[model samples]
Target: MGLLLLLPIVFVSNALVPTQRMTPWLRDLTTWNPISAVTAAARELLGNPNPAASIDAWPMQHPVHATPIWSSDY
Candidate 1:
């Protein structure tokens, strides 16, 4: 669809453009739709240096069943 093609265009254009001028449009785009175009832009900007790398190697807190206890549950 035409709209699908626009997503990548919007993402690349926003990423290549100066942040100042692009900020408004980027913000509006992200707020208007959390997925697709806006999401792509965000990933291009904030994603790790090696975007191709898998997230399994990334540092993150462990097992879902394990919860840290700072104090007694009471």
Candidate 2:
């Protein structure tokens, strides 16, 4: 049930649409999204090209550091 609810959120998050392409408000939303932080951290760890590279958001820039903070909040 939780997974179902979160599925649409994943599409709305930076996972599907690159942060750079979203509106400023949307980009900010995705920037603070825990999923985005996790995805960014994972991409960083896996050596994959980050889709949020073009955005100058702090979370995208320091995903490794953001991951711990994001996790603690949940």
Candidate 3:
């Protein structure tokens, strides 16, 4: 039941469609998705390839700062 509920969240968190490729509304959703923040933080820490890093979004531009902000919020 919990997994079912969480499935859509996972899908919308930019795993399926890169935020850059999503429609504007979806892109906005993905931008603030906690998963995106976590992923961005991980990529920054691990030096992994993050395709979205090139985008001009605040989270993408300052992932290290965004992660803590997101974490404290929820």
Candidate 4:
């Protein structure tokens, strides 16, 4: 059951693959996912290579700011 919940979030996000190659609807879904924000945030902070996203999704574009907001109590 754990895999059921966790797998979709991981696979659906950009952590495993770049969002540019995904379908438009799927890309949108992946871009807005919190997992993607977290991964993007990690890349930004750790100086990892982040491939340029073709679409300008707010979460992906500003993950450093998005991560905290997604995790916040408010």
Every candidate's lDDT: 0.34, 0.82, 0.79, 0.84
Candidate 4 lDDT, 1-74, residue by residue in tens: 99899887898888888888788899889989998999998998899977634458888888999989988996
lDDT for each residue of candidate 3 in 1-74, tens digit (9 for 90 to 100): 99998788788785556677678888888887877877877877898878778778898778888878877945
Better of 1 and 2 by TM-score: 2
TM-score of each: 0.21, 0.80, 0.76, 0.84
- In candidate 4, stretches whose alpha carbon ends up further than 4 angstroms from where it belongs are 1-3, 52-54
> Per-residue lDDT for 1-74 in model 1, tens only?
99997677556432344333446556445323323223333454565332212222111111111112211275
Report the error of model 3 at residue 25, Å.
1.1
lDDT at 26 for candidate 3? 84
Task: Give me candidate 3's TM-score against the actual structure.
Answer: 0.76
All-Cα superposition RMSD per candidate: 13.3, 1.9, 2.1, 1.8
Off by over 4 Å in 3: 1-6
Candidate 1 off by > 4 Å:
1-22, 36-74
Query: Model 1 Cα displacement at 15 (Å)?
Result: 12
lDDT, residue 22, model 1: 40
Q: Which ten residues in a row have the lowest lDDT in candidate 4?
A: 49-58
7-71, model 2: which lDDT tens digit per residue?
A: 87787677766777678887888888878988888988999998876668788889899889977
